[model samples]
Target: MTASTVLYEPSKDGITTITINRPAVRNAVNHATSLKLAEAFQKFENDASQKVCIFTGAGTNFCAGYDLHEVAGNSTGEVAVGPVDKVNGAFGPMGPSRMQLSKPIIAAISGHAVAGGLELSLLADMRVVDTTAVFGVFCRRFGVPLIDGGTVRLPKVVGQGRALDMILTGRPVDAQEALAFGLANRVVPKGQAVEAARALARDLLGFPQKCMQADLVSAHYSAYDSPSLEDALRFEFARGALVVAEESVQGAKKFDKGAGRGGKFEKGKL
Candidate 1:
């Protein structure tokens, strides 16, 4: 992989911003770029100092998906998609798409986040999109399948009917529509996605880390792992019970003194 294929920048305040740099093909992931992307996310995961991640693309676009040129050149039937152990840190065709990351990730989408790009965005806990951002299953026309958690995650994100419509039709869903679909958490003006995501990260930083992470894991487990309502409640209670002694007691004490009352949040006071 080229050195510039992916850029990993970690801020002093615990935010890691990972950018795909191949804008020539709208930041498409070639095999080499995919390796770089996997490595970049690995680096972020290893760093205990980093609390949040902002995944984005350089130039105007987020990513156009995998580079079909590489696929066109392959005479052998070998492809980027393969069997992976999702519990371990296995690289997907779109890099970190298969792994369950510990920290929160926010995707700052500026342009087309389509096909595999759309799958990549699904890896994020939240997507902060700009006015120009476009999302779709653009590879349907090319007979390409969603190999990197797209089928599983898309249905979970936008529900079965909406996901099937996008998957079958390959129609572009604009930013406003994506917001309505719950595909996007926040939408901003053009050229402001990254800044908006960074600002959101700052807010996340103010919260107690362990409590936030525990809640995040619980939510994900309930969404994807829990077999029944009883099991989900049991798991949530077990996880949250640990945080009560660690963080909730202190938080409650602060609330008693009016730290976060009346919906007023002061970072230092909290």
Candidate 2:
């Protein structure tokens, strides 16, 4: 009911954790909650010091989906749709699903991540799922379409054939199965998704930031924006070359000095 339904927690070590707090409805994002989520993520994006984001929901669940109760109450029988501007990006019905984040965000999943919830999880660079986590296109039973990048990103993440199986059947995919499908990057014991994600975020922070971000952006472009393999290669080289002078030189020096010998990461030293 209030903006506080979405909570933002920024750590001193540069990990920002954004939580959906409406556990009453299993953390479903209503219109107001969606706006709050968008605002919170925008804040994270704007803070240069914040390097990674951990996205999760409060209580037992990740998210059920967009609040259908809100849809049920709409007098016009239509949910409000935001205007889209592909260049600058725009808010989707599920808040920041349309955003192309400069830095990586990890989804720390517990319970259901279905329908719009599943789409939201797809927004992250990777997902850390607990044993209790469940993923599905649950809105299909109600004729609700996957409007928040589900149809687009899901295939890219898990392959088109696998994506079609989930999209068409609307069957629930549990954490272990999700790992095999390449949906969940890591599966931990129940209630440890957030902690695992935070640990992974810290690992990311230990890397050379410019080079990591450059590679991340290049990967995203190759997956969604590039016209062809050659174009993707050109884009990657250009972006990576910019980072070479800025970070790779220093990283190479560290490597040469045996700072990262035997494939061991020295945390902050890196």
Candidate 3:
């Protein structure tokens, strides 16, 4: 377990937990923070022992977005550290409101998830918001638009009209409303979102890996309307065929061993 400023702790069962550490600034992401995130994500990906990743922030907020003060500042003192490179993403893309992660990532959000914070929460494959949690696309009012996955993923997770309502108005939605909108999978008491997320990850660990990935791929592909229904079906068939070779064979054996429908799914737990 490598030491990291941005806490990255994994359980024995392959669930890597990542907690944003800058609580002093509402866990606002900065250059150093992004690097830590990237390193943690890459490590988890390479471990092979890990399967799922859970992301959360320490303290009263999940993430307040980027460090605005740092972004606004122009000076770096008298260290004589050469020119400031304009190339962004010096830190990896694993920061708040970032890119698509290959493995399923769960977010446990408590307190406020506003602006880029809310956008960051959207990165997770599944989100469990605290009952007191608040979500807002508030950056519209501040002129900082959801630069991450907001404009794109939000509409798909919720409905287009609902997403537009939030984006256009920059209104805050509570946990119950988020659940109704499908933005969050579950809602729990404040400070318990992480526990809930862990339980969900444990459940996911029981599911077949190849089957889940194939299903995940098909679901992602389903989001894009194909040229024809047949084309879409063909894509699903191909994904399904790949999984059938692995999980299907084991599934048959499970049935033979009296572990059929509704019984506990065997987990190789790699």
Note each model's CA RMSD in angstroms: 2.2, 2.1, 4.9
| Candidate 2 per-residue C-alpha lDDT over 7-50 given as tens digits, one digit per residue, 9 for 90 to 100 | 99998999999999999999998888888888899999999989
Ranking by lDDT: 2, 1, 3
User: On lDDT, who's better, 1 or 3?
Assistant: 1
lDDT of 3 by residue, 1-270 (tens): 643459989878889999888788888776677666766776876787888999898887888775666555635421111112222533222243444555788999988787767777877789998987888876686565555567877898898999999999988899999999999899999889999998889888887877886777676667645677788889899989987977988878877877755555444232
TM-score of each: 0.94, 0.94, 0.83
List residue ranges in candidate 3 displaced over 4 A.
1-5, 74-98, 224-231, 262-270
lDDT agreement of model 2 with the native: 0.91
* lDDT per model vs. reference: 0.90, 0.91, 0.75
What digit string (tens of lDDT, one per residue) describes model 1 on residues 111-179?
A: 999999999999999999999999999999998889888899999999999999999999999999999
Clashing pairs for model 3 are 97-120
Q: What is the lDDT of residue 61 in candidate 3?
A: 82
Candidate of highest lDDT = 2
Backbone clash count, each prediction separately: 0, 0, 1
Candidate 2: regions farther than 4 A off: 1-3, 75-77, 80-89, 266-270
Candidate 2 worst ten-residue window by lDDT? 80-89
User: Which clashing pairs does model 1 show?
Assistant: none
